[model samples]
Target: MNAPARIADFVINSNADDLAQQITLLAGQINAATHRLLKLIAEFDTCKGWSGGGTVRTCAHWLNWQCGIALGAAREKVRVAHRLEELPLIDAAFEKGEISYSKVRAMTRVATAENEDYLLMIARHGTASHMEKLVGKFDRVQRQRTDRQHDKEQENARKLVYYQNDDGMWVIHAKLPPEAGEQVIKALEAVVAPIQEERQRELQESCSTDAHGDVSAETFSATVEHEKRESGNHFQELLEHTRADALVKITEHFLATSAGGTSLQALKGAERCQIMLHVDIDTLQRNGSTHAPNPHCREFEHQQWLSPDTARRLSCDASLVTLCRYHHRLLHQGSFSIEAVRDEGHDSPALRFISAAGATIETSFFPQFPGVSAETSPLALQRLAPDVDATTSCPYWTGEHMDYGMAVDGLLRRTQ
Candidate 1:
């Protein structure tokens, strides 16, 4: 019989009270042997290419084909074996059967020369799962530190730039701090709320009407309930349309009010918005001399660029207000405002521009004229009339009407 058959026969026939103890010793011996075998594999792999026997490309590949081991297991063994060379303490523990290969593998991932001693102690006393958890926590902390550093770099690089495209459309590019970006997103969503609700109501009404134009309340109710249930799934869809609408609202608000010389305080309760513009005193007088060549002549809201003519128009009646930052350690002068909007659950509220005296200046500033689109051109304001009536107009209007031109002229005089 072969030596293997002899050992099998001996193992089967042997009967003693110490058999279990002997099996335990055998297990330790096998573990120690495995440590030595891995070291030899590592050395053979390192020198394989020089011998022209490296057709398998890698030691792990050779092991997979020659020993019939799974590629994943072979690769893991190769990795651990190579790492063990740099981890003398861990290699010693493995060779002495004080720690299993599973524990060693997890340790080597996050272990460095500085922490290897502490990690080896843990591997000797703790279970494999415990070792794995420690490694995971270490990796997470390291990643967080790296992320904070990256965010700081990004904040330092934050900027806003604008230029006119070939088609005469203004293009704006902005980089903002994470918190500031979040605030802007929230503000945009708030502005888009009524528009979204109006669209939803129209959709429900259309669904409720049949071919004969007879409305069904039951169908409308069902549609409303269904929409509410699926609203979360449609956040991405709503955000896209809402973003476009918000941009239009912002541009219209700035051009209509700021260009016409309205003060920040005057727009209070009308809309919660702010804009900054930089213009030279010379430019505002429409002098033939130009500062367009100097970059300092044009910067708005810290990042946007304005053409000299546009800057001149906006600065006509601009006033400076002091702003506090960083716990009052710094103070600077600029135009800004804080305004509040009335909250009406499930109902679209009317939008009105209000003055400091709490009188409404313009009603339905967003929807504008009946035939005019929300995306109307800035120049279109000359042709379209304001949507003012008894129901839509503010209580302060009192039957007298102010056209866009008259309103702009009034704002200019008030600011001056």
Candidate 2:
């Protein structure tokens, strides 16, 4: 919201009554609306907005301005609406407004199209808890589909084979399957796009001394990719969007750096600068030098293990892999990897700390106070950890030390 808030601490401190009331109100609202939509759409064979014109071409037009979504997004919504009417159970739930409209839309995609039976069972006799279990099952199935598609592309990718016509038109051929033909094209383009971007960056840099020349993937697709898939080309279009999302992510990494950078469209078969990471010391070791104080990725590991927002930010493609790597390396040794995964008691996100070595002990960086600050007030790290506490000397910290490190001016820093 509003271009993601610059990283901030969580400052919520609501009472139990407030939390319960908020949840109940939301639940009631969703149930009421979900029921109304299902009842309205189920009884009618065709929506007033839609008729048998069935242009297949007609769907894309609706997606843009009117629907406020992409062409693919609009068609998928229509497809789900159509499928909902086909089933009595989901349609009935829709009529009851037991779930939100958006939930129904997501369920349509995630719920296996091939397995109508699973949806039917839930529709007939299932609670919200049951639906959640079903959603997990759907997610697992979708993950499997994604995996198979990846492997198929890898094995099916081909080597180049060319044919020269008498008129001097040379046609290049590749061995990849129909599903991976786009991927093949993508691989070849990756090599070409960066070269062109470099030329542009150099040209722009030469034009002005003050200007930070940006040579991103936008120019590559514009100058190099002359042909793009049309509306009906669902699978291919989705694949390309996925690729674009990835490229955008790479470009965002340089935002943290002073140097203006480029995002080259350098995607090959199953190669998209992707990394599978977890909360562990091993991850930090790979990026950081051995002599570095904290060679482990304890901070990243803890964020992944403890906080959802930090984990999401770290996992995003938009966050450059390079920056994340650098961030990992900067953290102190043994200090980074999160070991206490199973959270035992209620925890606050005031000040999170990472130990350089020991696992059992975690120092609470945020000091607690009766008045502290208003729930909405900005926190001052200095107040949490004062420079010289009542005890004149700095506390000697150890693995067994219960006291978190001292507070520096408006910040939490190591004691000593």
| 295-387: candidate 2 lDDT, tens digit per residue | 232333233242344444566544333225443554432324432343333342222334443333233222224345534211232232223
What are the TM-scores, per candidate, against the unseen true structure?
0.35, 0.27
Q: What total of clashing residue pairs does each candidate reach? A: 0, 21
User: Who wins the lDDT comparison?
Assistant: 1
Clash number for candidate 1: 0
- The 0-to-1 C-alpha lDDT of every candidate, in the order given, reads 0.59, 0.43
Residue 390 lDDT in model 2? 22
**CA deviation > 4 Å runs, candidate 1:** 1-20, 49-57, 148-416
Model 1 C-alpha lDDT per residue in residues 124-169, reported as the tens digit of each score: 5556666677676655555566888667766887889899787878
Query: Model 1, residue 323: displacement in angstroms?
Result: 71
Summed over model 2, clashes come to 21
